[model samples]
Target chain A: MRTALCSLLDIEHPIVGFTPSEHVAAAISRAGGLGVLGCVRFNDPAELDEALTWLDGNTDGRPYGVDVVMPTRVPTEGTAADLDKLIPAGHRDFVESTLTKLGVPPLPDDDSPARDGVLGWLHSVARSHVEVALAHRPRLIANALGPPPPDVIEQAHAHGLVVAALAGRAAHARAQVASGVDLVVAQGYEAGGHTGEIASMVLVPEVVDEVGGSVPVLAAGGIGCGRQIAAALALGAAGVWMGSCWLTTEEYVIGTAMPALREALLAAGSSDTVRSRIYSGKPARLLRNRWTGAWEESGAPAPLPMPLQNLLVSEAHRRLMESGDPSVVPMPVGQIVGRMNDVRPVADVMATLVAEAGETLKRLGELHP
Target chain B: MRTALCSLLDIEHPIVGFTPSEHVAAAISRAGGLGVLGCVRFNDPAELDEALTWLDGNTDGRPYGVDVVMPTRVPTEGTAADLDKLIPAGHRDFVESTLTKLGVPPLPDDDSPARDGVLGWLHSVARSHVEVALAHRPRLIANALGPPPPDVIEQAHAHGLVVAALAGRAAHARAQVASGVDLVVAQGYEAGGHTGEIASMVLVPEVVDEVGGSVPVLAAGGIGCGRQIAAALALGAAGVWMGSCWLTTEEYVIGTAMPALREALLAAGSSDTVRSRIYSGKPARLLRNRWTGAWEESGAPAPLPMPLQNLLVSEAHRRLMESGDPSVVPMPVGQIVGRMNDVRPVADVMATLVAEAGETLKRLGELHP
Candidate 1:
């Protein structure tokens, strides 16, 4: 399964595991694949720095990556309080009313800051994520939405870090490569969270053709098992970037903190997810649950654009998670949830992927032999 | 390039080319692959009988197949006239007004029966198609929606014809296998025309896991080039079933009859299509154009159910074709349209697919060796 990606990323396997949990990320790096910790959930810079420091120690001297979300077009810069005021009153009311209708209990009053309004999706916060990541020993910095700003790319290069960007279209991949990204993750429509309308089978090759020679392409979306990884390689991708498959991994923070969500994902089928804008005001794939269904009802308010939509639903998302009801919680997962049928340690998953890919490649080789 | 599908279907390559033209079907069969002629476009039994007769003589004694559209559940049986009457007046007006707005001119008066109301989607019409196919020498009979009815399956088996069905979900494949289907075409969301929401990468392995040992699985959707065919095999499919890839083949009817439509397809990219119910009451992927755009506008009437919706838009489709304008014509195609950039003979396409798959397999083989 070795490819140019293994040499470039300094990993044993050509698989890149993406998860928001620092624990899962470290385990993946230790297991011989690149583990990219998603930094968008860390609204506070100090928290991201702490997580990266933990990863640096736990990875046993192996390389890991950090991913941040920054829109291709820089959004309006504003403070959390300023952005909060921009959310419409009606949108807030709709969220409150929907939560009440669904009987989602509110968070218990505590001194801890509410984990609402994931301000990390904003450009400024994501820039800070890059700043924190550069101070660590990570080897890669990935932009989830588009190419990192040129200055950020230059800074990462100065620190000898590879800068990769996720693209849903061939044009986007071309744009990312032109902007000096080291690698392109061709994330398809079937991927979790924000994605373009092209599926992996078509998108990977298109992206590969667009930028494979300049920058190795990593196929993503609906890729869970080793067969998919082999297929990705056949489609000209240098590697596979997987996310939703890790949601059920033992090291995933959600597996223990949100047992119901993990179970729901394990029990879901490919069709159980839907692409909708309710999650982030941008089109994204999410588990088809009560939250999405409510937003879909006739006369329901249309999701506001990006930051506003995420802000509007952030509290409701928090309440739904507190409710601990799997059917109502908003979870961003890919169609590959159908294949994540059970919990496994990151090492075990990595082993299975490597073994299965080897077997698949051997069988494919026999066809031509 | 060989698989169980090749042995079962008596073809040299594990590739199935699906097209509506008898000429294309015969060409594919002659090129060492199974060519399944889509029978849904033929409303008149005599016409289909003639087409099959032409295929019988033109395929150079090579094996071929016929595909018919039959919903899993039987709908109300009626003459085409009765079905046309069932279409709402407002739906008719909406179609008429939209066509007028798009400047699609009316067809010139001709003795050729109006090609409106594709009642072939109904059970009775599809059954008639099966009867016509059985009278011919096709090696296989496939139902597009689900398993052929039990009697039809028995009839096809009695006639020594293989029974195949297209399935979008694992359960659908299970059902088709249970109903004695010899093969399952796991059509994914990125496929042309009518399809399920699951993409081929997720759906193929799921279906293979469900019924591969019992019945061979053919991967469909988002498959155009040879690399995709190789990837399909990697995903555990016995072969690849392609539809949209054939639309630009020289033998396809639209190439000569509607050059603009063919040109539009050649120019399209992976993101140029959208899945909408406006094409047929059921959701089908169609080339995004003025027709689909009009249906999506505010205050536009919801598409009626399958038969009624087809009946409603049938005349509008006729007018769009007559207008010789590609931008307003309704063409059911897949995301793979992005790769169909040229016109070639069916033999050339098949040759390219085989050569590409062979190269891909050889390269993949080296990885493990």
Candidate 2:
């Protein structure tokens, strides 16, 4: 399973597991693959610092990375309070009404402030994430949207951290390389979260053709099993950058925080996902649930732009997660959902992926040996 | 580059070249790959019979296949004239107005009747295609939509011809195998013609897992180069079924029927395509042009059902073909259009695909060996 990426990233296998859970991140790195913790969910820098400290202690000296959501097309940046004002009343009403229709119960009123979802998406907060990540022993920092800002890239390099960017097209990959990123993750349309129109079959080779010698390219989107990993490598990707596959892992967000979401994901087929802007004002592949379906219905208010859209529906998303209704939450997942039918530990998943990929590569090699 | 598909199809490489042009098909078969000629373009049985007869003599005794567009959900079965009446006047007006806006002039008045595009999409006409194909020496008969209705399968089998069907999902492939088709073409969303939501990265492996040992799966969609062919085989497909790559071949249409279309295609990138229902009643990927863009605009009339949509726009399509305005024609193409930058002979394309696939497989085999 080793490739040029294994050498570059100093991992045993050429796999980068992406998850928001610190537990999963540590497990993946400990299992000899790079685990990238998604930092966008942590609106507070203190929380991210705490999570990184925990990852540092648990990964047994293995290398790991962190991912942040910094929009290439910079969105309106401000405090969450200032950003919330930009959301329209109609959009908020649609969310509330759609939640009522979906039978999602409201959260119990508490003195603790509601979780702010849009802050981390803004440029300022993402820079803070870069700062917090730099203070840790993380080996890499990845941007989910596109290339990180020039200053951010410079800062990461100064801290001896490798900068990686996600690109959906060859042109984007070239631009990311030109902007001084160390590597490119060619995330395709079938990938969960933010994605571009090209599929992995086309995007990976195109990106590799554009930047393979200059920088290693990791194939993302719709990659789960070992065969997919082999296919990605065969398409010229140095390694595989996987996210959706880890959502169902035992360490994913742990406990009851997203049991309903996991159940819905387990029951989904390959065609059960939809690419829409309803997730964060940017088009992302999400599980097709009532929450996503309602916004697509005729007469439904069009989703607002990023930051504002996430702000408007943050409470609705929270309530849906807590509602215990599997059919209502719009969780990000790839078309690989069809194969994720059971819960497994991160080590077991990594073991199976490495074993299968080795066997597949050996089998394919025999074809022309 | 050989696989089980080569043995089954009696070709040197596990590649299926699908083209609507008989010249391209014959050249492919002569070059040691299976060339499957698309039969849906020929509405009349006599014309198809004539073309297949020419193919029989030109292939140097090599085997080829024929593809027909038989909709699983049966459409209206009637004469072209009878079916034309069912198209809404508003839809006709929209097509005419769109043509005028695109600077597509009407064809010169001729004594011959107008070409009817929807007839071949109907059940009766496709069945006629099967009849004409069976009369020829084609080794395989493929249905584009789903499994040829059971009788069609039985008819092809009775004639000693293998039957193959295209599927976009695992379940669709299972159904095709259950319906007794010998092979399944797992076409993905990145493909040129009518496609489902799943992409080749996910769809190919899913289909192979569902029906691989039972029957070989031919991976299609976004497959243009030998590297993609290698990746498809790595993903468990027995072969690669290609369509868009042939559009830019020297023998694509012959003469000057589509010089402008070829130029536009050569200038296209991977992201320069959109999946829309404007081509047929079903969603198909088309080169992004002013014509497709116009239909996507607000207030544009919703495209009619399959047969009706084709009937309403058949004349417009013909006029656009003759108009020499490349930006107006909604040509079916995949994201692989990015790589099709030059026109070459079909033999050169076949040789490159075979050579590249062999090198790629050899390179991947070296990773572990």
Candidate 3:
């Protein structure tokens, strides 16, 4: 398990867990792997600071990373209110009608502050996140969508943090290397959230070839078990950056959505998911449910561009989550969900991956002998 | 290269090449690998018999195979003539208008018979092909689209030929195993021709797990070079089955279409391909040329169902190939086109894959040491 990536990140194994939960992140780091907390959900700088401070105290001096969503080109050019106005009326009508058709109940009439600002898809908000993340003692900072801006990469380097970018294509990996990234996370189309059409088997080696000897490459997408970890290393990746596998970890607390998500993932076959723009205005893999089916059905309106699409669906997602309907809840997961059948502790998951990978490596060595 | 699959197939290497040309197939077989001749184009039983006879004499006693496109579910339930009539007028009009709009000149009217019957999308024609192939001495028989019918599998076994099926999903692989397929080719979305949405990294292990020692699995899709082969074996595949890499081999003679096809492949990046139903009615990954782009552009008609779509585009494909126009040529390729930068002999390709995979395995071994 201790490869070059392990030495580079000072971890016992070359596995990095990406999660939104502080508990899972701290547990993975304490279990001898780097735990990267996804910070795109943290809109307020003070809240992000508090979360990092808590992680520092909980991890017992182990190193962890932070992941932010910062696209090189923001879809809309305006303030939050102005961007909200750019969403098409047809899309809103479709969302509302589909939810009504799905028999989703309306939210209770209570005065809660609008949670729109907390959804971070804007460049300004992500930049603020980078500012807060750099203020903390993290070993790595990764941008999920595209190459981090040059000044941000420079600033992160200046703060002695490794700058990482996720790319779904070889050309994008080259661009990230040119922009001075310390690591490139080559994700495949089967990955959850935003991904390009290239799969992990193709993208990893292409990105490794494109970057040449400049920076280490981390394989992402469709990586859950130990055999996949071994495959990633054989594809010339320095490590594996996994996110979907962590969703079912015992420490992953998604409030009311946990039970339904776990059940959906357990019941899902490999083909049970689809890549659609209904969730984020970009083609992201999500478990196929009534919500995704409604958007893809005939006569459904085309999803709007990002940020606007994210904003339009945010309310619907909230209502669905509150409704506790597993059939309609928005679950972003990778194709590897087919393998995530059980809810295990973070330490157990790490041990299984390491042990299985060790066994796979030994078996492969016997092939030549 | 001497894995269980190599011994099972009696090949020196575990590499299998799928090509439409009998010359390339014989060359690959002579190169100590299994060469499978794609027989979908040989709709006439006599023509297929002639081709297999040619392959037998040319391969120098090396064992070769035959691949047929026998989709488990026929899209249309009718005789060949009835299915031909089922093609809509709108699809024909769209194809003609698009080809004319692209300035492709009409074919010269020589008294050559309308060779349209040569295309085998109908179950009857594919069954005829299987009958013709079984009359020969092929070591293996493979179904490209789905599991071969149980009778077909039984007949192949009766003839002492190995039965293999290509699966894009784990469930499909399990179905094939249940149908008594001897080998499962777990193809990913990045594979050329018809493929499902699951990528190889996730699909291979899932398929392997599903079969659970019932049959060996061959990793397909995005496999071009040696490192990818190593990655496939690491993912627990017994061998590597490749199609797109052979399209650029020096012996691949598509007449005048070869130069333009090779140029397009060399210039393509990994993201330049899209999975579309324009070519074969099923979503197959193809190079993004003007032909594919026109079908997907705004105001374009949705592609018709399988045999209908294949019928509508057959004439257009013939004209494009005859015209030698690279921009509008219909080329079925995979994302691995990014790595097919040169046209080498079949022997050299095998040698490179073996050498590169050997080095990769050694490097992986050193990681543990």
* Native contacts, share recovered per candidate: 0.75, 0.78, 0.67
lDDT per residue, candidate 1, B280-356, as tens digits?
78889999988899989997999988787887787777777667787876899999999999999999999999999
Worst 10 residues of 1 chain B by lDDT: B108-117
Query: What tens-digit string does per-residue lDDT give for candidate 2 at A1-369?
Result: 678888888999999999989999999999999999999988889999999999999999999999998888899988878888888888778888888888888888872466477578999999899889999999999999889999999999998888999999999899999999998999988999888899999999999999998999999998998889989989999999999988898888743557888889899999899999887888989999888889889999877898888888887777888888899876889999989999999999999998888888888888883
Interface RMSD of 3: 1.4
Q: Give i-RMS (Å) per prediction.
A: 1.0, 1.2, 1.4
Q: Over the stretch B1-369, how does candidate 3's per-residue lDDT look in tens digits? A: 578888889998888899999989999999988999999887577988998999989999999999988777876645546666877777778878988899888777982444363357778888888899888999999999888888889899999999999998888888888889999999998898898888899999988888948888999999988888888988889889999888888898866677777788878878888889988888988998888889888878888788777776777888877777778778888889888888899989989998888777777766663
Error of 2 at B243 (Å): 0.3
True contacts kept of 1: 0.75
- Score every model by TM-score: 0.98, 0.99, 0.97
Tens-digit lDDT string for candidate 3 (A1-369): 567788788888999999988899999999999999999777677888898999989888999999998877876755657777888888889888988999988777893544373356678888888888888899999999888888999999999988889998888889989989989999999898888888898899989988958889999999998889989998999989999899888999866667777777788877778899878788889988888899888899888888778788877887777777778878788888888888999999999998888888777766664
Global CA lDDT computed for model 3: 0.85
Q: Which ranges of candidate 1 are over 4 A from the true structure? A: A254-256, B254-256
DockQ of 2: 0.79
State which candidate has the highest lDDT: 1
lDDT, candidate 2, B216-311, per-residue tens: 999999899988998999899999999999999988884354878987899999999999988788898999989889999887998878887887
Which RMSD values do the candidates have, in order? 1.3, 1.2, 1.7
